[model samples]
Target chain A: MEVLDNKITKFREGLAKTNLSFREESLKYAEDTLTELDFPTTRVERWKYTRVAKIANTQFSSRKDVVKQLNLPIQDAYTVVLVNGYFDKELSSKNLPEGVEISATSQSANNLLGKVATIKNEVFTALNTLYATDGVSLRIKAKTIVDKPIQLVHVITGENTIATVRNVLVSERFSEAEVVQVFLSENANASFTNNVSEIIVEEGAKLVLDKLQNESESNFHYSNECVQQASNSNFKINTITLNGGLVRNDLTIDVDGENCETHLNGAYILKGKQHVDNHTVVNHLKPNCHSNEMYKGVMDDQSTGVFNGRILVSKDSQKIEAYQSNGNVLLSDSASINSKPELEIYADNVKCSHGSTTGQLDDEAIYYLRTRGISEKSAKALMVTAFISDVTKRMDNDKVVEYVHNQLHDRFGWDF
Target chain B: MIKITNLHASINGKEILKGLDLEVKAGEVHAIMGPNGAGKSTLASILAGREDYEVTEGSVDFDGVDLLALNTEDRAREGLFLAFQYPVEIPGVSNVNFLRTALNEIREYRGQEQIPAKDFLAMVKEKSKLVELDAGLASRAVNEGFSGGEKKRNEIFQMAMLEPKLAILDETDSGLDIDALRIVSNGVNALKSDNNATIVITHYQRLLDYIVPDFVHVLHDGKIVKTGPKELALELEEKGYDWLK
Candidate 1:
């Protein structure tokens, strides 16, 4: 208790230095949550396989001077920039889709906004809400579909700096949209980043959210994503974490209605001393819903990867079908992977299965390729590409899949 | 132009080929028939430079070069091709891409420029027709999900593309139906020329009818137990290996 109070006091002191709005209320919320709730530790069920508290105890401060170094090529998509957890309108674009509404509001605005108010209980969420100068609230009107993807870029630039950002997405009935959140850090020094995003898919709606985390090797990243799907709605989340120091992502999907489909897919390629952890939970609250989760990791050098997936089928969720699979490949002997896939079903009529496997490159495949005149290195690269091709094929967008393939080839120093 | 003298090979510390001797000049077709566990595959593997089979005491000369010393891919670049009894399936690697890479690599190894895409596609179309393979199968992943007969036919297609100096078909007749067998044999026979040779290893004498060999050798217990003309195959078929035993 004393340690928690001291950490909160230190956090409050750090926030006081940042000249951002809602300083007082954010500090109060952080203090209250810190004192009331226990910080997620290694002992926590969901966090058992990951050690996040060790990163939180490092006494990171908000990066006040780090916002100037980011220089990204201007893209055609509607671009929004969040620097060190604070929205920067000067660096962002105002172009948005038709029938889409975006505004900054307080917690007591309405029921729609009230759903985001629960973020106060999470320390990082509370910190983002408290220190956030402006939060992006996106609401799509009924039956409206956005053709362009919304690009959210989060840039971290300073050393020993901590930043938190929040995003709230609400899709109206029969609407469709896609949101792409890209996290990048320009500097190679030590830094900390915490991000929270909430997505609500209404009845008969479809939402696709893609996350690209390409932070520096000296940064610690933690992200929490929560999605709620309504009747006959479809929600898909694709996360690509390419590089980071210590990264942990938490994804929770709640199927609140029947005939809904939820897909959670991710691919991570890590090297050096990087550590990446992905934890996902799918709760089937209604019957006749389908959920699928597939996550793949490719680790080299002394890097470490972790994957933990859980599927929960409630008693009334009969005839539900859920599948989860986690596959990893260790490119070097020094690399390590820890994967755990679990299922808990209270209904006997439901079909739920989960599996995980970790292996090195197939030797027979390598030999077979080499026998056909391909060099050992090229053969290994081909096998690695083949191993990850399934995940890339799942991306319905050709350009995105091509971009991912190029990124993977660049990492492996191969020209595909 | 291949020679193996006193070749002794082993896999996992178990000797499979014991002091085997064989020689084949250009423009010659040699058939090696044997019973099960007769080390015929071992001899072919050793000749193709499969690293899993160690040449404990042997010497293999291919086109006057040290065949045993070359790496698998280098040997492949040197015009040594092995048509595996069980072809490997490589998913996501299109057959066209795979064959193109192999051909270009071999060409580069021989100090030649890459084949132009137009020329290469023309070659693929021509060779694919020779093997009676569908154009769709030629673009899919390398041998992935291909039927047994299709795999064999694809092997011959690759052989035709590579134009190896010495083609070693290891039990290419197995798992292939009569029509596929005829197509594969026809493809192989079409590829034969005066400047290259072939080593056909089989357990049955039926395939020999389609691909008639100039020299037929019966391999038993890792050694050539008998040598005769193409009529030897018919005789062996009429009188099973029990007569030799």
Candidate 2:
């Protein structure tokens, strides 16, 4: 009991210090759940390859500082800056298009706060709910087509800092929008970022979320995104992870309506002692829905990668088609990957498939390239680029694709 | 352009090429005909620096340099080209992109400026036409889903683009039909000049019919047993390799 108390005290020392307000009943429930749950272990099925003891044992303090400017990837985007989980008004853009609103999640008193994300058995979601400093609540009104993409930049700085944020996104009927979430860090050592997002797509709405995680090597990141889609809605998300010490992402999307399209694509390139875990779940509740998931990873040195994709087709949800694929390439003997694909179908007349593959580069192909006067190093680089491009190409944004290539070249020395 | 003196090689503790000797000068086309298991492809592999074979005792001299001392890519940069008997199908690598990279790397080794993009595309257009290869296939993956005849023609097209001082065609006619064989031979003959040489390794004497070799060497039991003019190919094709053995 004393050890658990000490762990909670250290992890939550200076968190939830913002003066912003939140729902009274929701905060009470989250705090009660935190007392009942502890940090998960590797023995857990969802976290079989990830160990979170380092994040639990570290003593972190809340940090908030001012910065002059940021080198944003898309210069013309409608930007929002969150520094150490605090919304920076001066750094964010004030001009907004018609029918689009952006405000702090803490100040927004909406009934949809605890509807999508569940905290009953999820420890991270509970932690994020209780100690979230501040985040953006973006809403697109009905029938609004936002031409410019919305950019959300989460900047983490200082040593031993812990930032917990909560975001809410809602796309109304017949609306369309794209959101880019970029996670960056500076001078961070042993920092931890715990984030949770609850999203909703109304009828005939379209939303695309492109996330880039490029934190420092010493930082730990955990993100939980829960989405609910209505009828005739489309949702596509791309998660590109370049650098992180230990990262875990939980994406749960529920297709509660008919004729919806969902696409989940992710690519992670890891080296050194980094570890990344991606767990996704798609639930088909209505008839005639389609979903496709593809994830690719390239691990080098002592890095580790994990992928768990689960598809569930509820009863009476017929004529559903879902496909999932996960592929990995291990660049070193010490690097490894653990992949698990699961499907639970209680409905009849549905088509679902899942597969996983892991292997090294082809040696015969290398020799063939060498005979054409290409060095072995460049040969492997070309093949790896081709392998990862399958997922990166689905980003569908030129600026984001260029940013990913630049990150790969700067961090892993892989020039395409 | 190349000289092999008492060349011996083995794979997996079994000898393949034993005491093989051959020499070729610039502007000459040499045809090496032999029965199967007589180290016809083995000679091609060793000259191109395939690491699977262990050179027990041998020396290969190319243009006054020790060919056996260089790596496979270094040997390629030094003006040696080998068309594989079975061209590997590399998915996701375009032929034009790979050839461009190869050309630039070779030029860098020779202390030359990078080829301009305009000139590179022009060269590709001209060289691909030499073998009658479709310009669309140049942008597709290398040898992927290519027909056997198309693959053979693609090999000749690559040879034309590289323009090496010494070219080795290893069973380039094995899977090609008569039309493809004629086209490939025509491309090879068109690229021949006074500054380059070619070694055509074939089991039958069909390829030599078009690319008319100056010297025809009959290899039996891992060594060249007879060297004669181009008429020797017809004689071996009629009498079989057992007479030479």
Candidate 3:
């Protein structure tokens, strides 16, 4: 404990002026919260399957650089470019859409920032809060239904750098918007990316978030997404983790209002020695709310994956319908996965169920494809795409679906 | 186009095909009739390169290429098609898309270009009529929620699309109705030509009535104990296997 405290103190000192700037009050409060927190150990029940020893033992310095090059995959959409934890104006769009705002300046209303994400056992979010600077504050005005998606991309250009980014997305009443957030690295060197996102969907609003994590094999990525959904609102999140050396993602959604709907879907393909852990929580606090969560993983070679999903319905949350399912396919004997889907309901009138399944690629199915003249590689790719299609097809956006499909195919060197 | 010489195969040390030899030529239709546990399916499985069955002796030649040396998919690309007894249900894979992919792969193997979308669709439409496959089934997921008869007919429809040089029907008549059986056999007959052959594997003589075979072989305990003309099927159907032994 003493050694960890000393390391964290030195880490805080190491992050001193490299953040560009943070609101003084927010920084102090975040630091105070950090003092009361610790890196999650095995003792933490929520993080039992994930081992963070290497992360806790390694120290990463901050990086600062101007944006060199960035590509936007989405068309006719506003883009915000953040390079090495700071916003880069040269790479961002000059023309902002009407009724939408993207700014690097901090906002004073911190209602859901620290409320949705649990801080006691989350060191990444706590650290992000303390060192976040130049993060965007995006607001979609009420009754503004944006046809084009808003894209946010972060590119890391540093070696062994710890890049912390914080962003807040708000969709006001009766508004609808699709948002795509991408995390990529230049492969310049090994690095760690810690990202914190807080989303708020007001009454009668709809927000779709697509997060694509396509990092180099040498990088480690940690992301925490906290969502607060209001009455009659619909919120959906699709996470596609295509590649990374080590990755951990935490998504917690609070369905706090009546008649609200939430959808949480994740798909990941891991090969080589890559490791990925996805932990999600959906809390139902009101009546007549619906939430469905599904995650699929395909692991090959000696890679490992972990999925822990928990759905909680409070005592007064009546008539809540919640379902969670996790499916994993192991391609090699050495590949392994730990999946736990749990449902804790205090409401007598709620309908909730959770299931976890793990298996290898179906041999009979492969033979069937082969007998039809499909090669082994093509057949395996087809089966994998089919396995993950359940989650990918849930994506209502065609562009996002195509992007994910391309990534999955390219991972196997299969032609799309 | 296929020749199996003194073939010996086993599964887990138990010999299934013991010293079995057969010769099939282009434009020939051969029916292998057998009783239960007679290695009828094993023969078909081995010919299609199923890894579960290991051949300990002898060899198979497909169009003069050592068939035993090829992989399951390679055998398939080399113009050998096996219509499974039970078609697998592949969810999220449409019938047309899967057929297109398979056809393209086969063409690529044969040094041909991919078929245009319009031509492929037209071919699908024309061949689907051979087995009377519902147009809706071609657009839906492959064999998903299909009836037993529909699955059998779908297999024939696929056979028409691939148009292999050699087609093996492994109990394709089982679980199918009389109408389905007639449609399936007719589809097979329509695809047969001087350049192609068909192997019909069955336990009953009922299917042979629709698609007459030039030669009929009785297999018992992994070896061909009898080889005769189309009349052999009627004899087996009337007298059963007791007299053949």
- The prediction achieving the highest lDDT against the true structure is 2
Candidate 2 residues B40-93, lDDT tens each?
A: 999999999999999999899999989999999999999999998999888777
On a 0 to 1 TM-score scale, where does candidate 1 land against the true structure? 0.90
TM-score, per-candidate, Cα-based: 0.90, 0.96, 0.95
lDDT of 2 by residue, A1-416 (tens): 12345466567666654443546676777777667657777666677789888989988878787767776768889999998898989989999999899998877776677678873567788788877888889999999999999999998998888888889999999999999999988778889888888999999999999989999989999999999999999999999998989999999999999999999999999999999999999999999999999999999999999999999999999999999999999999999999999999999999999999999998898998898888988788878988888898788788988889998988866765
**How many residue pairs clash in all the candidates, one count each?**
0, 0, 0
Per-model DockQ: 0.58, 0.76, 0.77
Checking candidate 3 for backbone clashes, the offending pairs are none
For model 1, give the interface RMSD.
1.4
Residue range with the least summed lDDT across 10 consecutive positions in model 2 chain A? A1-10
Q: Stretches of candidate 2 above 4 Å error?
A: A1-6, A17-25
- How much is B8 displaced in model 3, in angstroms? 1.8
Q: What is the interface RMSD of each candidate, in Å?
A: 1.4, 0.8, 1.0
RMSD of each: 3.4, 2.1, 2.2
